[model samples]
Target: METDLVIVGGGPAGLSAAITATSYGADVILIEESFSLGGQLRQQTQLHANLPSKFFAERGTSLVKRLTSQLETPNLKILRNHTMIGAYKNGHIGVTNGKTTFEIEAKKNIIASGAAENAWIFPGWTLPGVMTAGAAQILLNREFVYPGKQVMMIGSNSFALEVVKQLYECGISVQAIVEASETILSRDQALLSMCKKNNIPFFLNSTIESVSGSGHVEKMTIRTSEGMMEELEVDLICTANGFSPILEAFQIMSCDLTHSEVLGGWLPTYSVNFQTSNPSVYLAGNAAGITSLGSILLTGEIAALSALESLQFISERDSNRKKAALWEELYQIETFFNKDTMLARLELVKHYHSERGLPLPDFVDPLKGEMLFG
Candidate 1:
């Protein structure tokens, strides 16, 4: 079959893009790899203790329901339990459901495959009980299952801390959160207080030397900054070093990609419009870079608008107006959560500026987002 737009994910970006594109009069087909629609959204829950249930995670759940209902639109078709394998010649896409593979032609495509958890490989990481913090999250939140009785986390970022809270709630004891950095990031301060109050120790300037078990992870050896090894018993060693965008399909599409350790590894170097080096393929949401749900939603809309306009499905004037309005919404969600990301953002800007032969900026306005060139 053929469509004007094919969105390759069912998460915040893909869903929002589908909704916007159909509203703007483009026929859309959404392909989700999961059996259900919601993407990374299904994995999130309460972000902070201060916020009520109406915040990011809960709001995302509600959005999934609302957006799913909108799929009743005649122009929008959904294909679940299906995935696009690759691109065919002449704007056609190879889609498969394992047993059967077929092709669908589309004028435009938005890849919103989202982010994958970073694998911080160390000794014994391949142990049976070892898992990423994201996996632990899915087990407890979605499946109502306990990941482990006792766990120790490596990588003392906010994401890992959030999992620590959930582990406590689920009655899974978190031994300690280990950080290679000298201190926990400021963004994690709020939850750090909560964790300390609950008696979860924070290990600074520490790293896991190794884990040991016969068939499953049973204990770990941690190396402190003083070069002393501390051994502790834990059923699971969870890695929470953050995430990288799932960019394999984009790579297959031959989009220009750049490595940014700050942005979560190799991400498509798409322009502001989310257009990749390949003119027909676009990126949205975590597939571009990790950010808030609000930013992902706005980017989805912007990408859909660009796709619609590129296909001549929407008027150029309407496209420009819609994109400008959506970008303003995106800019509002732009805030540096920690110093590392902030510096990385600056580094990214410098790299791009160097690519374009422009002078590196002296300072970027944190609040106003103004760039003063050096």
Candidate 2:
């Protein structure tokens, strides 16, 4: 197959990119490994804060619906159940649908392949009743099946808190929330208040030493902050350590990568426009970095606009103006919800530009009235 643009992943970011590219008269092919789009958005049951809007909120499902509704144009080709196996430097993409393998030759490609959940390794972690928090979420929210009667969460970040909230709403018992840090990692005060209101027990500065059961998880040994070991009986164990970007295709394409703990792990080095070292390739959404949903959506559009500008489908001047507006909106969202991450991104951009012997743009720190670079 030959196309103007090929998008990997049919999640929110890829969908946004496809819609934007197709609207601008680009023939696009979107490939997804799943039978349907939406990706993790389908499993999300909580309300997400809208971009640059303090009072407005939208559910993930609603956002998915809104995006998918706009993809009826003939310029867009949907390839569900197809996985992108290889991305080559020569603009050839290898894809397979379990039965047949094929290749696509594209002028430009956008990788919004998203992120994978990180595993928290422990003794007996491979037991049948032990699973990731994401798995537990899909079972509870999407499949309407309860994972267990008593659950122990291994992390206390935003993702873990959201899943805990859902588990509570479903009338399941959360035995305790265990965090290796000294305090809860989640910055959401509202969720923290909910945990307090419900009298949920939290084990801070703690680690699960081991879990044991004959056929499944039956009990766990936790080392508390006081250096005392405590044993708890639980039917299920959900680990929500964190997530890392899925960079298999990016590595295959040999895009320059850098490590940033704030950005969720190893990610491609790209400009503010989301163009990577490989000019023909771009990245968006979680593939770029783990960030707010609103910012992730904007990245897709920005990357699409950059690709369109390269193809001369859109004028560079017009693309710059649109991208500027998108960047401002993204900054606003990140400043509100992810100030530290936004600062880290600015630093990363500066480093990328400096390493290439390019002039660094002047950057002002949002939190402090000070110049970061000149």
Candidate 3:
């Protein structure tokens, strides 16, 4: 397959870019690995703050439907269940449709492959009923199934909170919400107060020591400060350490990446136009940096316009100021949410391949504990 623009992921970033670029008369090909096209947004429970009011509290599945419908342009060709396994020089890409390899030549490439959820393993994490909070959300939203009747959340971050919220909406009970940190992180003080008023048990400065059950998770042992231990009887455990970027494409492309604790370990440096060190390639969405959908859309549109400009299709002007305003709006959201600190702590981890002379994480048993990223 060949196209003027090849988008590597069909999330909000790639989908938005495809619609905008195609409307500008560019032929576009969008590739998504999953059977569907929404990416992580399809797994979310609630839309976060700072977005348009209409999108507030919208469900992930609903968002995917709306965006997918808006993006069905005549010039856009979408390849669902297609995965890009390798990238080559001179704007060539290698993709797979599960059984066959397809080579694509592109005038410009945009990577919106996005990020992945991180799994922090502890005792009994390999149990059949154990999963990440985001994974649990995927089960509920995508499969219309619950992990179990009762769930014990292992973290108190936004994802974990959303899992609890969604599970409640699904008529499942959350036994407890445990936070290893000393305090819960939240931008909305009212939400925290509501949690307290609802009598939901919040354990701070605590950690899950182990999980145990006959064949599935039935109980979790949590160790708290003051040398106290508590066994919570729950049918499922949801570990929520947070998210990290999907960097396989960056590694294959040989782009220079660094471990920025603020950007979730490995990330590539790109200009405002989303151009990587390679002029023919661009990046957007969480692949550039973990952020909200509003920011992701703005970055994607800017990248599309920049690519058009490079091809002598669009001219730069003061009208571009709209992007700057969008950036500032996202800046306020980030500031209010305190994402900088969390991102700062995440910079401690990095990704490296054997030939790159960078040390990768030691996976004792990859299949048992590994998290897949595209």
**Which model scores highest in TM-score?**
2
RMSD of each: 4.1, 2.4, 9.2
lDDT values, one for every candidate: 0.77, 0.87, 0.72
Which candidate number has the best lDDT?
2
Backbone N/Cα/C clashes per model: 0, 0, 5
Ranked candidates (lDDT, high to low)? 2, 1, 3
- TM-score result, candidate 2: 0.94
Better of 1 and 3 by lDDT: 1
- The 10 consecutive residues of candidate 1 with the worst lDDT sum are 48-57
- Give me the displacement of residue 258 in model 3, in angstroms: 1.4
Pairs that clash in candidate 1:
none
Q: Which ranges of candidate 2 are over 4 A from the true structure?
A: 52-56, 359-374
lDDT per residue, candidate 3, 74-141, as tens digits? 88889889999987555488999879987888888888889887897888989988998888888998
lDDT tens string, model 2, 54-161? Answer: 225778877788789999999999999999887555658889999988889899989999999999889999998899999999998789899999999999998998
Q: Candidate 1: where are CA atoms >4 Å away?
A: 47-59, 336-369
